[model samples]
Target: MDKIKLSKEEYENAVDEIRKFFECERDEDIGNLQGQIMMDFILEKIGPSIYNKAIDDMQKYMTEKIDDMYGYMIP
Candidate 1:
């Protein structure tokens, strides 16, 4: 798959969240550049697995819904 790209707003929001997490949990102040680097690292290393898992979950949900839909068909 091509690299996942977030919109500017999303990217900024995620970076801000990362900065807040470090500040609150680790007592460290991380700048935007650092947060962006960390976000990129996570996307490279962890995003694919998470994306696949979500796809699998949605597939299962849709399959179950489709199975239920068959029950509503007329004889």
Candidate 2:
């Protein structure tokens, strides 16, 4: 797939919308299904390249959060 470029504003808006959608799920199983649907919608709307980039960015953000939490727990 060709690279799909997004302006900063567009990326922020997409992230906000995705977070809101996930917020509506009541449990982990439902949230996972909702996340998959959200991802499919995003991929369909934005294409693979942009979707993959978003996924990578989110993974990095989550890893940083986990590391921060681990650091807080260590002596």
Per lDDT, the best of the predicted structures is 1
For candidate 2, the C-alpha RMSD (Å) to the true structure equals 14.0
RMSD of each: 0.7, 14.0
TM-score of each: 0.95, 0.39
Evaluate model 2: give its lDDT: 0.67
lDDT of each: 0.92, 0.67
Best-fitting candidate, scored by TM-score: 1
With candidate 1 superimposed using the best TM-score fit, by how many Å does residue 5's alpha carbon deviate from the native? 1.2
lDDT of 1 by residue, 1-75 (tens): 777788999988998999999999999999999999999988888888889999999999999999999999998
Candidate 2 shows a clash count of 0
Runs off by more than 4 Å, candidate 2: 1-46
